[model samples]
Target chain A: MDTDSPAGRARGPYAKSAERRRQIVDEAYRMFSTRGYQASSLREIAGAAGISLSNLQHHFASKEELLLAVLERRDETPAAETAAADTAENADENAAVPFDAAMVARAAANERIPGLIALYSVLSAEGVTDGHPGREFFLRRYDSLRAGYTAEFEEVRRQGRLRSGVDPAMAAASVVALWEGIQLQWLYAPDRIHAADALRAYLDLVIVSADDEGADA
Target chain B: MDTDSPAGRARGPYAKSAERRRQIVDEAYRMFSTRGYQASSLREIAGAAGISLSNLQHHFASKEELLLAVLERRDETPAAETAAADTAENADENAAVPFDAAMVARAAANERIPGLIALYSVLSAEGVTDGHPGREFFLRRYDSLRAGYTAEFEEVRRQGRLRSGVDPAMAAASVVALWEGIQLQWLYAPDRIHAADALRAYLDLVIVSADDEGADA
Candidate 1:
């Protein structure tokens, strides 16, 4: 019977606070793509969000905190993709997620959220130093990504869908590298480099068919 | 060819000046790997090189100039690599310089001057903006690198040393990506992740053979 009062109270200031935090995260993420962390000050970020320094501080408190939040959100993309892949390969969880070079390449070339790509390309590059705030986060990310891709390639190779001499581990690492490298170029010269076609071509090389030489001949 | 005339007069101060400039560049490049372009200050760089601020200024007026010098030096790596490949391939200019993944990988993994790799990884990331100083430099670099690698891959393909379905252009882009991505990781976790092994593994995947499947089957 008293649910209404409690619920209303919870919905009022708490809701606004959540919205403010979300807004700060959005502005910080936006800056990450363009101005980047080093170039943009926390004050500038607050100004971009049309919020007072105090308000922004109340939400993130520090630039590193805000960046971590952005990284958390950034994970949504690959997490979403992997989940979708898992769903598609539901009948057998262990089945290798077939490399869809052309589709992935085309999709990357014409992605909806280019900001994600920009944010990643810039931030990952900057995270290589000794004590970068995002160092641990990026290292873990590379490990997980390489491991995931490696496992997939290994499965595919085991099934003979990859060339015999093609080492699954190496292929996995290369694929990860291919993606990042493609994104790096795309961020700079979007018009010149076609990420999709480039990726698809690499996939064609690795993904074995029943008769690669025969078809070509 | 006077023994000690105008040429010797020019040599004294010029020699000292050249030595000073070289010292600054060396320190600047060393700092780039450890502290990065964004984090290291000009003053700190001068301090590291045991030179005064005024002396540093005499050589490189700004961070951009210093960075350009280091990058110029960095180009020597690939140039040396290609030259060695050329010598190995004889007078055949069109030889599909075999993608030496293992050698490249090992070289990258155990590089003596890791500063060059570190400097590149950091600067390339920072240059991802619209008009960052290094933007044009990096863009041109990617284009040149892609074109060069593409030609090499094309030669490799024509020689039937690449997988049948692999498009040379795509393979070239992938190779570029592979190097960059691997370098990115190597900068981050030099001990944990061996860049050379990973790259060699990838090379094993793409480089074709006479019996890719026939011998396997």
Candidate 2:
């Protein structure tokens, strides 16, 4: 009984299971965001998702597992987009790179994904302690992102796009830090600030291109 | 019944009380840093401090109160130092301000403060929801910090020290965010990163001086 079988398509148990998981995750995210992880209860999550406690447990095993799944799903969105951008950027590495303001603008415009951003920030801070599953995940996530940005910086440096004495690894770390930091603040007071504008301003200060000669040295 | 009377001065109740409070905070910090607020218990904290539960409650009214006091005390250290630096820097506002490379270097050299930093990171994330005492504290702290940095940035801008079109408020927010973000990464892998150096590099790129005119525009 494959869920996608043509005969079982209308009465597919797998499809229902998948939909139930999505519904649970969506409810959990809302509850966690509004009530926080400690204060939110599994019963409430189940109630909000319109499922029985047994049904919820059948899908998720435990509250922690459910929370992890929610986080994983949220993280996948940006990871996929960033990966695609990296691949495209890598393909054009040999060519005289045309300034891609549109691509940067698109990433910047993703400021609307505040819930997912907030989820990551909250989970990351919570994950710093030992034995937290997300601890390893966050550590590896940052390492890979830092490595990717550092490699991009090095590539630009090799092409003579960077100024002398500028350390690419350090700069990449700082940029990532700035992005995460602003996201934290934005989570607290979304109405008072624009994370996208803040990020763009930071990028403008650090990243230099052949087209822009007189940027920050 | 003065505890510091000549005979009791050597080991007085008052002195003992003060010592006990310090011991409690130190142990609380350690426990909170490792186990987090929700996971850590008062009995455990008292046990760690080598005190009775009653004595621990005598020092701090409640677990929440103790956590607040511990956090407040921790925040005071950096605020005091920053205030002193602000006063000294403001005194020479007209002069060619010397950058405090040593201060940054000292921060970079020290890796022991990651626990304190991680505690704040975790609490701040949890504080986003309503009813968390730390929510008001962090919100006010950020507001005041942003105001101070904004004023400083405005003064520097008036003196023609920074690039044009840069918003002081946004820049200040970004700076705070970057600082917190770097702290998060450092907490995860203290052995692998120099957060202070990363911060300094980013600051160097963002901040320009009147006397230095090397492609800042």
Candidate 3:
């Protein structure tokens, strides 16, 4: 995301362009979340971004083009961040998997970016149908994230961290399901459901330890 | 659902009316799932239903009213079935909570009605924002379902079926999350993830008994 060189940073126009793009993405995300992808218009997006229609079009030729920009910024990069976190977790030779705490922390972070989260939730359901523009992106997301989670479980299993008889594929899939379920509930009733705590509890049950045999169910 | 008495069953006009209503519901659900609640129009729904626009309107006063009818038929009645299933489970004194397997079966059955499931997934995400007409109904559905699940868990716990140390509310919330999450995944990639099996495994982990100590993770 920070593609600015020292020279690029110093140039006023480059910085301005980058700033304008960010504003458009942010405003567009909020609008897309509220009005949805099909119903929302470019003029509305332009107005929301405080830029003229021509100016907005100058940056991105069409609404679909703008949507790709918003989606790329919102989902693809954060997925990389999640992958990095998973890798880091795997790298720790002595680190106990604090899956519970990690889930809690992630939920807390989500609370700060309701717009992006809303965009994700709304579009997630929207994209599931046949031939929707966002379907491919969402499917790719599930493919990669599920792969990452499965890899985490396999490695953890090797380290004797994952409990016995747990299928990595199933665990990975369940994790995705828990995540989506908890997120949807949180969006619908944030005050009623704690996404992180709910995830943490599931993690605890899944990631059993040697001593957990004596632990309460 | 089967309200047909001998007289009702024999009457062609009544049967035709019922069939027409069902066709409208099916078409509306498919359209809503694909195009979304906000963007999809009454004309389009009527066209898809193979009925006159006015006739469709007669059956369903508006698109929102049609959506409510779909929600009621697809979700509400099935939810009642699930509750009855739960009550039956509670009645079995020797029954181990196969909450996960039951979850899977329910999901597989959902696959038989992709239109209804897709309608749910699509509309659920759409309804999270302010001023969405379906928001109140969805929120109430969650509140009630969560309460029902919690009550079931509490009763099961009293009977010593739920694992010790588990909170019923959290457990209920997790079940809801898993169901939502798994369904979305199945919609996205039916080939990759077996939503039911994924849910069953998570259930096994959470509802563990003393015997499960030696069982697989």
Candidate 4:
């Protein structure tokens, strides 16, 4: 069978089918992140991607499908840092650090990702249901995040950076909880709070070095 | 002109009408808690309460209305004590005790109001939206809870309960955040964790006496 059909032609030789798919997903992400999932229409996504609605449908069957794809794409992004712990060979190098200032800064910077934060806040609230599409996604997402933090804490312990007898899992869970809880507050009073700063302040408390504790106290 | 029209008679006595509304709300809460808001129909709640849907609607115009009423009712109940710094001369002496095994045992031994817990977990997750009726309610609820905790911490400080240099507002916020965070986990994996126990454990950490720090270490 000839590969140069109308569809094949639409996906140029330089731009493979996967590339086209990514382009569509990227546009969808931009739209959804800006206009919200409920307000951003598939037609607008198609228009933004310079493709027809039918072609968009050929790529993603529905808005839900596109949303799932956007989330999946985000999941695959290296920014999540799920494998950062396992890949780090010299975790002790940063063990003496008072806090992961770089990571906190990066997370803080993400506050400017337009509607991405609001989208996450909205979807998470909806994700509590058993059968919501985002349910398994968030569960796995949180689990992976928890595991990543736990691994970091383990490294901190190996280097004797953690406070004596600190339960890493509980501490990590508390950190995650603080992030989410603070997100809730930010959503309610966006004008009054800086979610990233609040999170950074909490992290500062937990990540205090042995030398810093006396100063912190 | 008649005070005892068929509709009036159907509502029963004044006291009975109030009781019936409470009963309907309680039943609706149970249904919504177990089945989730979208899945639990007004018909099912009515059936559970042994009343017709019309009767239920007469008391609450919609399922959302009923859920709100139930939530409002729950708000009137006493919450977990904030860590009070001071004990008033006539204040309950046991207020600062961390919720522990005894509390869980009491809760479990009681009428199995898993419905209320379930309702809270489900609604809290869903209530993150801007216009959701429960949104403002929860915002105020959390604010009140935080205020109460902060007050208790300040009181305890005055009474020499809390250690020096601890910021009571920050500590109170942490406690609230931890409680909310654990609740998310409990929702996803009820068999793996108990919200009450997790909260109690965290509270225990906060309330540890200065002399006991050595033992903890």
Candidate 5:
């Protein structure tokens, strides 16, 4: 085999170690998504990854560390996509889509990644309690998300896209709240709840198109 | 003191046992609210209640069973209040308030009981995982809430209270989702997130008054 080939280069200890870590994270993600954080044990994850408990502990000192790794991997996948999209030639054009509309679009996209949704729904809820390893992650996540949303809503309001009587700050909070609530419901009853549809409904109520604004006036 | 006087009679073993059980549940509720379900241990709860581990176990066989008792107590508190109001002389008049509006009122009420909200937010989110002890409770709770909301929305629509272009079923689901989502956010940042305000805003968008409906038509 050619030494330059990806498979031929896998013989090194460093690469093997990295590959093993990736396998552990993948197994943790799967187990966390289905069994949740507290219920899924380190032994089960190590077993699923075809590694011994000692090896897993060497990679991740504790289950909390492994959980953080799994969550980080989940976040990176989307962050990477967004980063790639940001560099695309039509990036500026893509920015024309309003934040609320983009949110609805993302909710639709989330349907295909139910495992991530399951993991998020479980951990974020679990994170609300004191001393949960994921608490700070969620607090920062929610704070940043709400701040980003508030700024976007302000911009939309400035463009006269928001309904005349709507308050941008409240609207921002509502959107975030709506997304979280709808997704939680969706997790409980996926067949019955429509996350994207509910999101779009809410957006339509608060955000008006230029044509609709003209008609309203 | 007379033997038949309220405070004069010596307490029976049954009353003492009931009081002890109540103490355990109360302590469990407090710990569960702040520390969350998974982070809280039976030993700590037992200690907080000033009972030994064996005695605590005698009253409640498992942590899951204790959790159920705590949840049941929480539910009963609200149910008791609502029941009192239901039998009030003006109960018919109170029924005139739309379901969404009542939910906003409840959100405001929930602010005074942040501990319950914390407990609920943690468990409901955690319950999304498979085989969680609270899963059946949350599943039934959400189902009943959604159904109630839908029925109430249907009535409101019949009375011309729901805004035109709003579907009752979606509106019902949205209201429930909004409550859950906003409350979770409130748990994270109590000072910043206005649960009632967000809920009322969403409700106003979906459920308009007679005058607003007339203007729309």
Candidate 6:
């Protein structure tokens, strides 16, 4: 572990390489947000990151891989990281908060980062194409989101928090849809459509307050 | 107006040219749906339509213009045409159906044409970026949709069809968002998420049926 040792000397370039890779992903994320995936060429991203395309490719073999890295980078952010952790913990029934509440918090966090939200809005929709690189990433992301939201809604239903006769699965799908749709609308008119407000509004419609629940259900 | 007359002869080329333009838009629509706006090149689209690049340019002038054409083409379809007509007629209170009900019919129509839905899903989301050609179109579209749905929901409120305490504007926005979100989900998992069913489910939460209205109110 000594800094002067041969292994430590070898670690220098590897560490620098990792840093360089991170820099590339950072540039790609910015470009993907501003210029979009189609317009942001690898050369442009590499140039912006102060590296050559060949060097960038040494880190990410293709644009698709680079796109995934950018997406994963967003996913690795603190809020998203916590959400992932909570998902794993939910199986043990030890999650600190329900999935829908976590999503509301995430949406609030997203408001501070319009660029990332725009990137997600554009890519997730574009990824619906048959051969787009982001296709599988989106498909899996949505599947996971729908399943998580559904489970959370089901839990609320069990507790009699869900409105009478509201289907958890359908509500899950609608919430997922609303988030995606609202964010895109927010991008257009940020002053009007707040993601947190929209989510809360829909949640209120489908969820009963504890006081109201006794009379309703 | 005789077919053999000079003016009539001139009309033939204009008619053919319009048909050729239609051909380009149709081809662009197919490509935009299957390959996406970013991935579908002008050359490839032109090649697919059996026209030269310059010829395509003569018709569309730019990819953005071509994109607008494709989007407008979809908008000019019967369902959209009727919606526009109804919107105009709505001012006189002569509109046969409410906007939300019209949307339900539109969603059902959308199910039959997955390609158009994919095109819309990809473009509307992608259009959120600063300079996307579809940006103006979608912005106008959403603004109009939100206004129309809000008006209809207000009407529902007047009749005691809307759930008590629900905000008409918020519900309008959520429904619009849900449609966009659900369609993308449907693209990924066609069998699992039906557009009409999802819209109806959300509507059921906010809008009471005739028999239930008296009981609820």
The lDDT leader among the candidates is: 6
Ranking by TM-score: 6, 5, 3, 1, 2, 4
Q: Give each prediction's root-mean-square deviation over alpha carbons.
A: 5.9, 5.2, 6.0, 7.2, 4.7, 4.0
lDDT of 3 by residue, A31-80 (tens): 88787888788899899888899999888898878887878773345432
In the order shown, the chain A TM-scores of the predictions are 0.80, 0.76, 0.79, 0.68, 0.84, 0.85
Model 5, residue B43: displacement in angstroms? 3.8
Tens-digit lDDT string for candidate 1 (A1-217)? 3235656555766877877888888898898777566666789899999989988998888889988998887434454332211221232343344446423633464455566677777778777666668888878877776677677666666666775566666666666677777777777777777676766766666676745442211
TM-scores, in order shown?
Answer: 0.79, 0.78, 0.81, 0.68, 0.85, 0.88
Better by TM-score, candidate 6 or 4: 6
* Tens-digit per-residue lDDT, B86-130, candidate 6: 232243343666656666776777777888888887788778766
| Segments of candidate 6 deviating more than 4 angstroms | A1-10, A80-99, A210-217, B1-10, B80-94, B209-217
Model 2 residue B112 CA deviation (Å) reads 2.7
Residue-pair clashes, model 3 = 2
Which run of 10 residues does model 4 chain A get worst, by summed lDDT?
A82-91
**Local accuracy of candidate 5 as per-residue lDDT tens digits, A139-213:** 887776776777776777777777767777787767777777788888888898988999888887877775664
Tens digits of per-residue lDDT for model 3, B149-198: 78767765665567656788998888878877888888887777666677
Better lDDT candidate (2, 4): 2
iRMSD, per candidate, in listed order: 2.0, 2.0, 1.2, 4.2, 1.7, 1.4
Q: Check candidate 6 and list the clashing pairs.
A: none
User: B43-133 in candidate 4: lDDT tens per residue?
Assistant: 9889999999899889889877887787767544443322111111213445555333334333333224444555665565456543456
Writing each residue's lDDT as its tens digit, candidate 4 over A101-138 gives 54465456555552555556545544565455667866
Distance (Å) between predicted and true CA of B13, model 2? 4.3
Q: lDDT for model 3, please.
A: 0.71
Kindly indicate the candidate among 2 and 3 with the higher lDDT. Answer: 3
- Interface root mean square deviation for model 1, in Å? 2.0
Docking class of 4: acceptable
Clashing pairs in 4: B84-B152, B84-B156, B85-B152, B85-B155, B85-B156, B85-B157, B86-B155, B86-B156
Ranking by DockQ: 6, 3, 5, 2, 1, 4
Q: Candidate 1 versus the native: TM-score? A: 0.79
Tell me how far candidate 1 lies from the true structure as C-alpha RMSD in angstroms.
Answer: 5.9
Q: Cα lDDT of model 2 overall?
A: 0.68
